[model samples]
Target chain A: MTQVSTTISKEKCFEQLLLGKTVKRVPGQYLSGSEGWLEAVRAEALENARALNFPSDRHDDWRFTDLSPLFQHGFQPVSSFAKLTPGDIEKFLIPGSTRLVFVDGCYDAGLSELGFSGSAGAHGVTVSSLVERIGDVQVETYFARQASFKQDAFAALNTRFFEDGAFVHVTGEAAAPIHILHVATRREAPSAIYPRCLVVMEPDSRATVVEDYAGLEDGVNFSDAVTEVVLKDDAQLQHVRVQRDEKNAFHIGHCSVAVGRGSVYAATSLAFGARVSRHDLHAVQMGEGAEIRLNGLALITGRQIADTHTRIDHAFPRGKSVQLHKCIADGAAHAIFNGKVIVHPGAAGTDSSQSSRNLLLSGKARIDTQPQLEIFNDDVKCKHGATVGQIDADSLFFLRSRGFSEERARNLLSHAFAAEIIIKIPVPSLVESLSRTILDRMSGVRT
Target chain B: MINKDSRVLLEVRNLRAEVVVDGVRGVEILKGVDLTVRAGEVHAIMGVNGSGKSTFSKVLAGHPEYTVTGGTATFEGRDLLALAAEERARAGLFLAFQYPVEIPGVSNSALLRLAYNTLQNERGLEELDPLEFEDLVLEKIKVVEMDASFLDRSVNEGFSGGEKKRNEILQMAVLEPRLAILDETDSGLDIDALRIVANGVNSLLTADNAVVMVTHYQRLLNYIVPDYVHVMDGGRIVRTGGKELALELEARGYDWVRAAA
Candidate 1:
């Protein structure tokens, strides 16, 4: 028996890069010249492993939940690819937006259509593949100067291995909205798709972007995605992400948003599937009078598991942020919520509040919620609270006594619990559709 | 004595119940009670606080906590003891609760829809969808003079004492039960609310239905006159008379009845 070790030198890295370069001239893109990004990812993965093996005993963050089920199975990188046609793209397209299709982690130009008018002129908007813009000097420079990657392991992995994603740029005076619909279809066997989205809004610009992750069939798959957004002075952006995958899938997504002076940023995440899923959202208010609003909704049943971890950082004076996350868990499913708000020194006049509420329908269902606040400045107003409880018994009995059957009573209570947040959505039809879907998932328990 | 040919709507025979306290059963509340009500007539039962007036009402509606040791109540010649509380409601037996329960997050309109559908189902009839039910409920809301806005609010949540009682009468009006039992419906109401509730009850009276008014005061009787007034004492009807009995009881309190007993 013998053992062999393989080592790669710096020259090997350059050779591999040159062999993979296909574009003649790199368009303006992010994360092309960052050497530290790849190194940071490797370190974060080791840290995550250590945290899993030996958790901190000082806090009760993970007291109610057991993480052994997630680490039971080992996952592999995706290799097999699925080819998608234009008709397939049309079948899965969202009603109101331009489509950007990615098959097996590779961008397909023939399957994607961008730009409202199909014009090449610069009208304060640009949409293209990351591979075409990776070599641009400006994109490389911006990637180097922004974001800290050592805290999150999945973001590091996406930064290191994501081949091609979507790059959106809005000019200073742009007014129209740009919607980026990212569709990921699973292939045979255990596969993975890394969707990286970079959105930049110049000064005085306004836009909205949506990222959607879905599976085509029932299979063991993984979706590792990261989205970075930069809003310049007085700019506004509304970002929404939806993750709906098969029961055998694993999804890890991260969203990092940066806001400048007097800018407004709002982001929402809706998770309804995947056997194991984790979402990390970080928003930073860098200048005075910047505001951020983050809302999240998750529905879990069966043996599914979903964790949402979010943080909002206030670095300047008079910055405000509010975060609300709600979860409904039934059967043997488990849900986790961890949200933190940090107010740094000199960040006075900051008003921030965060609340996480969970509704457990079954005795076997479990939820762990941790809402934290770290403030250094005394003048700031910050509050955080978390609550986990079963549905009110009095309410159930009242409904039942009113001629609603037992099943109908439970269904109405569940709908009313989840609808408190769903009704906040601006679109009426979308809210109704989501409400109906939630009710259907709940019907099994009532029956 | 109940008239045999008067078309009996509800008949209770030998109804015995008890109040369980601290793992030990206390004195019997309703001890071998017998009563009968005829359709198209209004009956009033006036009693003191401990006379088991409310207990009899709750027992008939099949509240789970109250134990029925030996009893049988038949509604329209059907076994009422075999039915659950909700089943009893669907079988045309309405009990206006003494303390109407507050149901948070459930709108009044939605609760009415469920009640309407359950009644329809028990009758083997087709159920109305939301659009049609809304139209039907809006027409019935006027019977109680309820504001249309109340339909959007949660059931009895933040409602005043008078409003909750009025809400109960409103439900009874919409349900249109064959036997309507008002258990202290005038407990917390002012003069105005009592008049409105009494008017709503009067509007629902018909030859095919009956009303059982349980009260301790004669004020409510001044508005909705009763055909028969029974004085209940120690879980039994000690005296029975025409509508003048209520006036006599008002003039001379329960002391005269207790002295006679």
Candidate 2:
């Protein structure tokens, strides 16, 4: 057993659960209606899970963020949705919108529209729990395509334990985005949750998927999430994830996407909570003429830490990608960003640009960023840059001279620095909501 | 708006100040400087380079780097030095900075709205909506013949020197303060831009308000004539006279004033 952060031993944590030589599907899941091929796939996933290893600091991908704290707690899979009554999920819910709600790691049939009769069926969208939809036609093939448990150990861990998550298949175009809320309910024993989401868009279709994670602010919890997205030819998808987890919570989530030929994938991930969290976004342009935009913001304060690592690979010619991620850390906080764009050997005429900017509002606050471009094709145009600094002194004084208080001036300039990326979100209410969150976090923050 | 006994818009008495370096040592800039300006007047303080003219304007705005060792500044009989910089600005004192800052992401319209709304809140007046504010800002933008798109761009970012000066006047127009201190507002402006800025200042001048122009040249006086011109040397206002003093100081350089003093 590997012993780290807390007094609890690794045996007292995930050793017996995730590190087992041979893993089974979570003890009690709703997998009754599965057939031969789907059952065979599940058994194969379990075999793959058994061969996986936990990520450690020694690994290049996990070097910056430490998961020792996560390995110090004993967690159980939330077998059913009967753990807690659905009470606070309404506050996080967008009014009059179709959504799927998960408690701990299980989907609450009472709280989710997927369980209702013809709820989202008439809207040209299919919504269901992956447990029940494993044998269905649209979802059976797209489950493990993008986020390969065979490669990512954490994803392998989630695939072994995750029971219920949102399964959304959008036809033509969704009338309204399907919102997925993964709410965590803590117990006496420290709990770990693996939230999963699979969004598959049909050819020539368009849709949006919002994955929001919420939990008690002071609770001891852990969530490692995996979301796999597939955009078929000429399909467009806008995926937004809001992470406002518990303060003592440890969250490490990854979103893997495969952009089809001439398809567009736009994503924005806002990280505003957790003790230590890092979001990984890996997008691969699998076909020609694909376009992708990945933008994110992480706000950290106190002793908190947030980091984001993004990689966009141009595999075919005429692929385009734009990446911008920002981090604002105050107090004794730490924020890190590493964004890389790769142009393959034959992927000529590929245009890519990536920028990673950070704002340090306190002397003790730190930021580390590396924006890299690795291009093999000479004809491709690729650019990457990184910057880290404090607010402009002259701008602050200028605002103050115009009748803004010192605090107000700093907040306005800080907000402007963040809005350079936050305003790009297409949802109006979500933009306003996230703006208020950023402002509230920015209140009383100074350099 | 000037009536009998309109008001004493600004009065400075025996102002002594210095720039505190590293928060310890002090370099004396304004030594025993005394000045006064009433409503319905434009006072031009002419000085050679490094005569502490800019320091005096900044000190009035409560710049933190400047320390007022001994002095009292009054605006409408209220002690200005006792208030914070924003409070001083709210009390109708506006300083047109010599070097306007270029804030990359903040738009000009947003900056003007915040300043205008804050002033309205200070004075207990009704704030205008966005459309009304746009109309008001547009009306003021014409004073400098500024392009309408200037309001849409980031504040002062990438603006040419002439455009920056005109932007300062445009801000003065949007925020109609009682005392508008133009610190080198004429510097770096072309002849055409100088005329537009001078004309904007002339159009905004009211008998109930005042203007203070700190300049090194007499050319600006040719456009917006000053009622009084004060010569500053060795951190003191050694001489004061009518607008003719500006021409005299121009024809006969500031060396004559220092030699006579």
Candidate 3:
């Protein structure tokens, strides 16, 4: 059996993904939006998506991750939404919390539950669809503002075609969390779905938002998502994002956040599934005396590939940021992490630190981790480190000497490695559920 | 106190072992070592550095780095060499490491409870729940005079040198093994810590258990009061006598033992 290498040009690849040649799945009514302001933005995004070439291994940023597997199979838009009940997604529903369910990138009003009068809650918080709140000033002002798609092809594609997503606006305080749940269903043919989210936190307001992307079945699919977050003065937002797609799926997600004066933005993102997954997170501290924290963990095995690229920009003086990202790759899995923290020239008195720690559980597993720090001011304090290693030999022997079987010892160490990030999630139930998922994944790991 | 007719807890005859040294294998560390430990006996094997005192203890505990090229070891008439490390642990053999490994992110209480539960299952006994086990751990922490806050921290992470050794003793108190090997357990302890650690080990001794302390200094003998002392020279036990021999070794260096051998 000879393996053939087909060198398809980037222009042809883009044409195959976007041109109306494969399959047109969305209904005409779903594509029409009342907001005329978005039409120009969508048009601009379409042109950008066409002009920019799909990144290849030659691209320095995408050197380790390959996109050929995604292009190998043609994906059609999800034509019809799957019929799902609350019981069908019971595991995803946070008890008594407001939730917005999107099945195959199409909003499912029947499955979503909004407290107070449908989408309007206490403390002047509004959790509704972007299309429904088209005329709102804040939604119109903040949507498609923070996440720039002119340079990123995937982000551009999501901007050009996303039908509907959640629009969350907090005024005073939101005690109950708002969950944006994206559930991918098993499709007859390989499909592509776009999920988008926009969050705006008002001055001195506090809220917690959980963005979860999960699948109902282990089927071939593509999830291209973009989330934009903006925090005003003295605001605090605890954001938790989890990606648990199907085993044979492809996921490309980008989240860009703009933090305001004296505000705080903390995020914890975890990835567990998907044959090939990539997440690009960018947080810029645009205001002085602001604090930002970004924690991520990727637990993947088999031939899975999980790539995480993050950048924290301290653009203002007296800003602080802390980031810790970890990965546990088993089997022949590959995990990549690139964390860059830039302290701008005028950003004096900036205190920032970043660390990327990875664990390889097998000889065949691979990890490429790099911590890049660019400091332009000598008055700032920045530290960064990276480590890629197997499980500690002495720790393993210590557990074994305490009467734990070798397999159990390995699982415990791996669980502890992933739990350092899981314990930071503000939701208790989500932490418990994610812990069980990690343990189940690590149980089958031989090393 | 040594009994004349008590059960032979651990018996080793002509034990030979080798460990890799600087990427080279088959470097014999323990050569022709023989020893016997009866129930209720505390024996201290004193040796200079590179004399393979730690090697002999690790060999008995089934450390994977050491290959037992020849010889036989038995615990209560069962073949100890054939068992794995954890198997040896479940068979009531415990070795207190000189440099305890610090495992970050694993709470000390979690490790203790899991190890205790695993040993319970091995003995066909009921496992303790978290609540029940917390009560037991609180009581055991007093044996080593450890603060309760240590249980909530990661296992041995950022612990001071003396504190790490005491943590080892705390684990020993929790497991209550039949035959305990203290491998250089007194290397880094201050005077007060030495007393507390010695008192902890002394209190755990019973008529059905034995202890083998491998050390270079005789100061620890003043507190634990071993019943017998053996001087190891060139990977072999050259002299064996009552505790008075430790005092003699303190008076004269180990060179006398090497010359006598």
Clashing pairs in 2: none
Q: Write the per-residue lDDT of candidate 2 for residues B1-261, one digit (tens) a residue.
A: 324366788889989998978687488999988988889889999899999998898998878888998878999899999989999889989899899988766788988988898899899999887788999998999998999899988889899998998999998888898999999999998999999999999999988789999998999999999988999998889999999999998888989889998
True lDDT of residue A307, candidate 2: 82
Location of the lowest summed lDDT over 10 successive residues in candidate 3 chain A: A20-29
Task: Please list all clashing residue pairs in model 3, or write none if there are none.
Answer: none
Candidate 1: which pairs clash? A27-A133
Show model 3 residue runs off by greater than 4 Å.
Answer: A1-13, A19-32, A117-121, A444-447, B21-26
Residues B155-205, model 3: lDDT tens digits: 898999989999999999999999999999999899999999999999999
Best by DockQ: 3
Winner of 2 and 3 under lDDT? 3
Q: On a 0 to 100 scale, what is the lDDT of residue B202 in model 3? A: 97
Candidate ordering by DockQ (highest first): 3, 2, 1
Better of 1 and 3 by DockQ: 3
Error (Å) of candidate 3 at residue A7 is: 15
Docking quality (DockQ) of candidate 3:
0.52
For residues B62-175, what per-residue lDDT tens digits would candidate 1 score against the true structure? 765567888788998999898777777877888888888776546788778778877888899988887898898888878778898998887898999988888888888778
